[model samples]
Target: MTETDIPALLALRDNPPFEKMHTVAISGMGPVGMVAALRLAQLGHDVIVFEALGGLSAEARASTFHPSSLELLEQLGVVEELHAVGLKAPIYQYRERSGAVLSQMDMTLLEGETAYPYRLQSEQNNLTEIILGKLQDMPNVTLRFNSPVARVERGDRHVRIHLEGGHRDEPILAQWMIACDGAASPTRKSLGIAFEGTTYDDRFLVISTTHEFREDLGEDLAYVSYIYDPTEWGVLLRTPNHWRALFPVTDAETDEEVMSAENMEARMQRLNPKDTPYEIVHRNVYAVNMRSASTYASGQVLLAGDAAHCNNPLGGMGMNSGIHDAWAAVECINAVLTEGVDATHAATLYSELRRDAAINHVQARAQKNYDNMRQDDDAARAEQADQLSAMDRDLFEKREHQRNSAMFTSLRLTLGRLKRELHAVKAPAVSGGQKFSKLLGQGPVYAAGAYDAVSAKLVEQAGFKAVYVPGSAVSASVMGQPDLGYIGLAEMAEAVRRITAATDLPVIVDGDTGYGGVLQAAEAVRRLEQVGAAGIQFEDQLAPKRCGHLAGKALVETEEMVAKVKIAVAERTSAVIIARTDAKGVEGFEGALARAAAYAEAGADLVFAEGVYSLEELTALRDAVRTVVGGRPLMVNLSEAGDSSALPPLELAHEAGVGFLIHPVSAVLAAAEGIAATYQRLLTTGASGKGQEDWKQFTTLLRQDEQLERASRLAAGEA
Candidate 1:
């Protein structure tokens, strides 16, 4: 077949030996970790859960569930079952110590707008048990107590986990590791991620009693009532046949003084009055702290649940936020396992999204809730409580504002900004010869306002192929050839497979002198052919080659390169083997030309006379190739420094007899120029806000007639 008529290359497919997960280890078995493991096992992946605690324990933590989180649980197919067991509290009452109800929130008003309008008041441990039941049913899931990962090791292909189980002193190896451990996690400590934040000075001495004051309350037993008086302020949450009450206690308060059953009964008597009859069931104490890890991912180790971020339970966001992290991690892991996007970057994105969400939305709101509770000065605290009460009332009853008060309004606005920030795409950096192609495709076009998708469309619109190198492009790197011998033999094979799948271009892959000496070069060439690469190029530079523009650049001996070229040509099955000479600028034009001629005589399919500085040099090299090999193809580097200013593509094809031109630095120039222009504009304005109106216009551009007209014209192919 003719060269232009060569068959269309199909995408390269990988059949990884570790195709299915057999033993998956999760470091934490908290609510998020437990739920995630259950979901993974439900999807048929063998799952192992490790918890520091020997068994599950009851805790009155994170009791309020948001409507969004409930919806998520429903999606996981567990919320309906959980809802059946938990009390759906539909209203919150704010009252003064004097027994006057200041304001009340009616969550039932949220009906029709959400599937679950009322917040569920089940203890977090109960929710954990619910998830545990679903997890236990999965045949592939194993729950191990008193077992934790000691360390983690990762390779290009798989991650090895070091496990310290309760029964065994020795460590066990697992295929993959997930650190879902809680806040103050050993796994996070091992990963070297910094947890940053402060613990509140206040703590809660929680008392559970079979309190029958529901009738004196004159409210639904499910209602969560907050006492607004500074000295007597606390929460009254109802559970089955028992009332779990939390009263704020200063850190200075002794545990003996706070935990005394007599003191607790007196506190309850002072708040509920009429000497309310009750039966104390259980009691505990907990401190509230809010912190965020500096990073969520370090190589193969990942942070999930409380290990990543901890929030105050005032707003009941702690466990709920952890659940969100679990969901986000699942999506990220799926992307890495299915798509070729780098695993590290994917993990980083997961951390960024989850951490930001918790810090900005959950933690901040929880702090506001704390402020409403712990403000000093009785009169000022009362005023703040009254405001919170009024806001809650307005939020529940005021339908015109969507029943949204200042709190919910700020929440919506914050969440809106978060969504916009999360959706913003960042353009990447490019350098070296790769910059040529980037500039040609994106620099000018993106300056004219085209990004990756638009730039690709522009290429398709201009009827040209748009190829991308996974990493930044280096000079003399092979285009179509597979195998990176400099890194490793196994890595070389994978790189070859990736390039095959990446593009259908006659891949001009740089073999860096065929992955070593002549024998290695021959074997690498054979592997490249087996992987379906169209061609391989061997550079004239000596081993451990540095960039051409750098100092102390060295060249391989001309005869040695010729020998490698001969070996490469003999080993290839259906691939072209091009020999490159990086000798033009290093040694004068004569040395480069002579090397090209020798390579051609040595049966090289194509010869590259790199660093040709002038049209005169290119002309001489072209003529020399004609003398030796007649009309064999010749590759040229159309660099800016090459002094080929007016040598357009058609002109080069017609006048120079050059078969290919590698304009690698074009995109890099365009990107750097655009970024610099933006920086300069920002400096001129003394701020980065002027173009915001334009950005808003672009974001909401459909409302503008001019934009709509342009869009319509573009849609109609009139642009």
Candidate 2:
């Protein structure tokens, strides 16, 4: 293919034409695996589910299902069955040991956000069993009980599993393998992926009893209550037939001591003192860990639920997010089998989206909740309680309800995190680079600067051809620090990842001094490649890097900059590498143009001269670099208007045949100004209200309508 044919070629290769279903193997019969099996089967894929155990356990596990989970389950047509055997807790409370209510969030406030807003006080077994029942009825599904998956052999295009049960002589082969097995998954172990995280010092001690906690605690107490004490923080949960209380067993205690009848009775008595000993029906202890696999997808095998991640149960995020992963796994596979998406692209997209969910959402929130409940400083803890108490009912209900409900989902977690735009993890048909290349075909188009997923959404909503994620913006918005190189490679890449997930627009990210030297720049190239960065521009500025537009900038030697450019081009997978020089401000304009040409000659896909003093210099650099790029467009960094009077306007740049313009600080400036005004309005008026119509408009940016359409189609038995 010719150089100019790259766009049409990538565009064509991205959307290959074919559709074929294949057999899928699901390991483990937990809620995650069951949901995967059911969804895949419902979508008409041949599915075989292997369970290590003979049958489902009635143990008390993951009793509180969130509203977001309910909405997702509703899509699968299982919410009604789940509700049939579950109790709805519309209100949950955070309480002091003295029974004083610190804060209570009424789920009713989120009724409009979700169809079923309350936490369903039902064990995870209910959902698994319900799905299993449906799976058995479906002709596309086959269940294998008493069958433990020993390991999986990955093939080029499929997976083969060796079972430990009597099926050792019979290796089962399938096109896809989803390991929803527990944290100690054989599939994950076999794949050799690291499950990196920490095992908490405290072992969880759970006691299930016939005692009615709501009646004893008080009528005002909700069915779900987290009571805090410096000595011991306890969680009181109501199951369908019993009340379960969970406490932390320190290293000083053993499982035998924690689960002993006397200790269990005393713990229950402390929760609700009674004349007679509390009726402890069952008692168990298990270690809790906060961990997620390095990657959720590998070749044909995909890890879901506990196999991919584990977390503290305080927020009930484990099972809910796992269910979300299960759906993602199925959706991605379906995309490959039916939607004509490339198989590897579909799998990688699932890994990127779900691993993000596991790390940033599930594990992070669980750890935060654990820390919140076990705050050691009395004054600080009391201050937090006071803040919760003083928070407006509407505000508290809105925030806490979503937080507790796991509404801050990873797929669309931006609003959930930034209170801005949420990341939607839907699979895009084209790679970011492919999209970017096609747009570059239009000639001299600019990218709107996005500091976060929120701004990326705004840029897409406003119809920008591409997104420019600046390291300066990350330093300013995230760290609240000036762009003097406070952030590193990982931080900037994460910003790009979140922004890329928010929209289909191509994102060109800034690599400040390559975060170090040549080796570091190579790693930056690889990291940016993994995160779907459409383009990456590496500058020649020294450490403690200043923004390109700022004064007192310095540039490395021309050979050094060229070496960085050479390494980046050699290391990148699909991202376009634009070599940038800060020489115009540090050296001379001619020297800057010389460095840009040198880097371009050294194999840079594009070239840029930062701190260009005038439109004349931009045009000169553009002409110099085009000789090496085979007619590829030139790039310019356009900061805020206040930053420089020498910068050229858009019309003039386009007129000059410039292509790739970057408004690197526009969104940050707008966001800062809007935030200042909002805070001032709240201070002056004692109220800051956002109109429902405004929220509606914002939700559209998250693709809520597309999400609803998919859910509607799924519920209506259409794939």
TM-score of each: 0.55, 0.55
lDDT of 1 by residue, 1-719 (tens): 11121111101001111212234568877788877787667656667687777877565566666665676688778887777778877776666667666666676676777777677867677778888888877777778777766665553223445565423222333344567878878778866779999987887778887766677766553357776555667777776446777788888888888888778888778767765455777877778778999988766566877888887666556777777677666655554554434556666666667767777777887777667765668788767766665665565344322223212333344345434543343323221122222222111111111112322233234333332211113221324222222343345455556554533333445566565778888888877666645556778777676544444668888888989988987887646567888787688778888988889889876676665445555666766763211132466554443444434333333234444445434444465577678788788977654477767754542336677889999999997
Q: Which stretches in model 2 have alpha-carbon errors above 4 Å?
A: 1-22, 165-169, 392-397, 400-404, 414-719
For model 2, residues 342-459, the per-residue Cα lDDT tens digits are: 6776677778778888787677777877888888898989787776777645585556646545554464552133212112233356677756654554345467799898899899
Model 2's TM-score against the true structure: 0.55
- Specify the highest-lDDT model's number: 2
User: Model 2: clashing residue pairs?
Assistant: 414-422, 414-423, 415-422, 444-659
Q: Cα lDDT of model 2 overall? A: 0.78
